[model samples]
Target: MKFRMAKKSDLKEIVRLLADDELGSKREKYEDPLPEAYYNAFSAIENQGGNQILLVIKDEIIIGCLQLTIIPGLARLGIKRAQIEGVRVDQNYRGQKIGEALFREAITIAKSEGCGLVQLTTDKERKDVFRFYEKLGFTSTHEGMKLILN
Candidate 1:
């Protein structure tokens, strides 16, 4: 498998991956229906900017996707941090380490860009998912709170 920055053309596949049951439930619950805004946000990031959305491809097929945002921070002072989000592997490809490969590739990209740290948030109800993040070397450092605005 090869990791590459996503293109606008990949939006459909990305959304399909996101819509899978394991990943889409909460997002669907809130959004009820997915909107073009979500796709637009991802496409903007996937373009050549400080932010990036990457895809794992094998044999010209998109197998997974992850978004990385490089934040220029005052706290880090010339340092940046990467916020990784929407990591999802194709339902058929789970348990094959494709997700890990995608994450490691993102980490490499972040490091090359001088990111001081990489951060991500996962739902607390998914205990197994939390353990997976822990196994991947992420610590539960902060509580995440959100206020959704329609």
Candidate 2:
């Protein structure tokens, strides 16, 4: 698998991967005339300095993707941390350790960026994902809460 930054052209495939699962099927709209919101959001991220959308390509096709945002804060001794989100692997590529490789590459990138910590939040209902993250050395030391503005 090859790891690289995502491009605008990769959006369709990325959306397909994201919408392949049950949760994403309800949340993501994968249809003809792809939504403008997706492109707008991608452009925003592209213009942001400390944010990135990464892609994992296999055999010249995108198979997985994730978003990473490096946040600078006064806490933790003014260190920067990387927040990972939107992690997804192609349904056809699940159980192939691609997710593991993706995480490892993300960590490496975070470290290179001088991130003191790498953190992410998964849906509480995803028990299996929790285990997967734990196995990857993440700890559930604090509760995560979110409110949708829209």
Candidate 3:
């Protein structure tokens, strides 16, 4: 497997992975010629200096993806942090260590970017994901809440 920053051409496969799960199926509109909004959002993220969508590929097939953003904060002595989101591993490729490789590469990138911490939030209903994260040394140190405006 190899890691690389996602390109516009890889969006379809990335969306496929994102939409494979029950929770994602409700939110992602993965279709042939995906909605324009996805392209627009991807463009916005691509233009951001500290944000990137990373992808994992094996034998030329995209199988996993995640978004990483470096944030500058003043709370911890102006420490910079890496915020990870949209983590998804292809359903057919689970239990093959892709998830672990993804995180390992992300953390390495975060360290190279001078980030003091790396964090991400997953839905409470994803119990298996919680355990998966714990195995990677992540702890539930804070409570995260969200309010939907849409």
lDDT of 2 by residue, 49-150 (tens): 989988999999999999999999999799999999999999889999999999999999999999999999998776789888998999998898999999
**What lDDT is reached at residue 44 by model 3?**
97
| Candidate models: Cα lDDT each | 0.82, 0.93, 0.94
Q: Per-residue lDDT for 4-96 in model 3, tens only?
A: 999998888888999999999999999988999899999999999999999999999999999999999998899899999999999989999
Tell me how candidate 3 scores on lDDT. Answer: 0.94
lDDT of 1 at 72: 83
For model 3, the stretches where C-alpha displacement exceeds 4 angstroms are none
Best by lDDT: 3
Q: Is candidate 1 or candidate 2 better by TM-score?
A: 2
User: What ranking emerges by lDDT with the best candidate at the front?
Assistant: 3, 2, 1
Better of 2 and 3 by lDDT: 3
